[model samples]
Target: MPSDPNRKIDIECDVAVIGAGTAGLAAERSARRAGARTLLIDDRFAGTTCASVGCMPSKLLIAAANVAHGIHGAPQFGIHADKVTIDGKAVMNRVRTLRDEFVSSARESIEDLPDGAKLKGKAKFINRDRLEVAGKIVHARSVVIATGSSPSIPETFDGMNNILTNETVFELDDLPSSLAVIGAGPLGLELAQAFSRLGVEVIVFDEGDAVAALKDEDIARTLRGLLEREFAIHLGVKVRASQTGQTIELAWSGESDGKKRFTHVLVAAGRLPNLQDLNLASAGLDLDEHGTPAFDRRTMQCGQSSIFLAGDCDADVPVLHEASAEGAIAGNNAARHPDIRPSKRSTPLAITFTDPPSASIGAPASEDTIVGVADFSDQGRAKVEAKNAGMIRIYADETGKLTGAAMAAPQGEHLAHLVAWAIEDGLTAMQLLDKPFYHPTYEEGLRSALRQICSQSQVSFGPDRDEGSVPGV
Candidate 1:
């Protein structure tokens, strides 16, 4: 197949944004709004991994699996079905359709941006403020590197011919009968559960003792329960060796008893930054000791003030939302030219769409404050909806200031917005509790959790009484 024609352009802009993923798109819009001439460049003309292969494709498959699981397991809910089977080919076709829709919709939004900014084939730094794009050289006052990441798999194990990662997973037409997912983080767990629900016998392995180690323990446990009910879990394990056949072979280092076992493996480890082709040394930008762009967190200016870094390439935790947020800041900083005022608030909220879903907002809390929790099983709405197993946990300071909120429940995605609002506004637990919440709603669970913490805090420490230290109260 012939490659797409390079849309050549030789021009100068106030801001040149690289990578047209979530962050790059946001940066271009923000820079244009700030009255800066911006140019956006990406390797994928239609969509990159996140658009075509990563997020969209995975979610599409997961959605189908969820529906299939619901129908297959409906007998317990008193809903009768003769038999339920998943058409693997049909599922993959639907995923392709959704992916195409994403590219179409994304293009419409991209076209709405300022007409001056051009989306080119590829972008690489020639000098500090100069970039080579699509056989044309362009200069800008400031450049933002928003190039995203690609899936990374260690080469210790063989059989990549059968082992699948996020990049190649979408290319699969038929589901594996028995599959082992390496890495029990968000991606691994999500895919494991999705495949299990789709009737694939799935297992997950990871170096960590539990999945989603960075999340709150209670929330992770709840999500783990849902996954365990569907898939086998091999924790604190490493891929040692592998051999492929009609059924892919694998060997792993078990966490307990230090035993090595064999199984069929699927690699869902994580992503590595895409910076190999970009000659950063020419622009005087070098990777930090951490292997990421060494940039001032406050300014996002890498090496020099003229070149800004954004997205997963510069983030401590990589995600679409965080990338876009940082990209906006970078674009605004880029527009400011020489002198720039950076944002003080840099908190990130993340969500994992496993079974009931898991979400977290703000920084974690010290062990001293009481960690208030409300189970969704106690909520009237969840009980009625038959999704009452998850829990909501909130951390608050002595003065009732919201510290953090984490939820493992159905509609946790919706609950996250309220938590984000509370954290952003610095709402007190008493204030949040007193607010009128609609009865029998998932959000009412939020109000209930805050009220419980407020009541307990008041009772534990009387008015004008000095409180002694208690372990999370």
Candidate 2:
């Protein structure tokens, strides 16, 4: 293969996938399994987003920070010990060591693809049915766009290169003494809390009042208070930053005013889809008002039947699992001689890896839904662990079917998974109550919320009712 963009070489495949990230890898594997002669293309074969930077690495760092935090707070258990010291460099090295293992595992999964099955190049649409990649033209029956996304750095902070995003933050060999994290979204909150626990003087600024896109107001408020006790949180604040000699100066408005300096600034504002180099207009696809390609979220199909999209490029959901599911749907549909029936979408699950993690599953709060809440302040397991600091809120439809849930509590990630599964399986509040829960466990809080909802339901429950029976049995 030549680097020259003008050199012409023609290749053909039943399915052509762009970008070798999570969604692209999934699409390529699915398309091949569907019997398509798939050609996977990307400018680089770096590991999937989760393994490389997004989920896995962040969680590793959070795990290390949590250990340090636990030791510092160990006196609450009446176990007096010597002062705990943290080695920032050693902690980060451990995170990187484990992160590299995850990335290597992901890379190994696709290493066996045949020589001609994959191409390294930046691909652009020659048309709906063809793409130009590494000076080679690929003609394919169906095309999948899985270019993923990049950190969204605003133009105002263009010249200062010391700013960190999730993409680069984990690579730090030594932690900064002070950090100013802009945005209270999952990435921002998770990293802020992680660093704060590891002894960084963290200051968080979010334009929105909520943290991690939490829908339940009470949970959001509780989370804000909990995080504020650990770090300086300035919510509903508009922030501007500039490099000031050896430090970064942050000026904000809203709850507070004036300027502060930090050793480093982290911009976890959001993400932008990697769409610019695709030349999507050549394929006759128009971008939406948000500047993302027009695609049906349910089917992951672009405006043209032959073109499809998955993962961050779709811009509907950015989680790794959601991207993987969308990739399967897009790949199956693209590879099928005549398109198969559309697959059902998975229940939405979002988790922030902060201490007393916050999570939301399925639909957000709305007028039609009944809400139930359980505070962790008195939760048995949480109290025993000295981690009782938040709450769990569940929502059900008028008919009592579980619809959604939001939680800011210890082991919330596990609870969110249970709620998401139940909602996906169409379980009702009463039905969820029937499932056996261990005594004095974190799940008991979830059961309490379910009981509250069931008690309020117009339909009576009975042992005779089946697993997903409606409110009245």
Give the least accurate 10-residue stretch of model 2, judged by summed lDDT. 464-473
Candidates in order, TM-scores: namely 0.88, 0.94
Best by TM-score: 2
lDDT of residue 74 for candidate 1: 81
Candidate 2 lDDT, tens digit per residue, 1-473? 32333445599899999988889988988999999999999898888999999899999989988888888888888877788888999999998999999999988866878778998899998777888887778888999999999998877678885788999999999888899998899999999999999999999987887788887888888888888899988888888888877688889998788699898888899898999988877888878987688877777787656888999977788898889998888888889835655788988899988878899899988987788888888777887788877988999987789999888899999989999999999999987887887766888778667867877777665777433422111
In angstroms, the error of model 2 at 408 is 0.7
* lDDT computed for candidate 1: 0.74
lDDT of 1 at 297: 69
Q: How much is the lDDT of residue 398 in candidate 2?
A: 78
Angstrom error at residue 361, model 1:
1.4
TM-score of 1: 0.88
lDDT of 1 at 97: 83
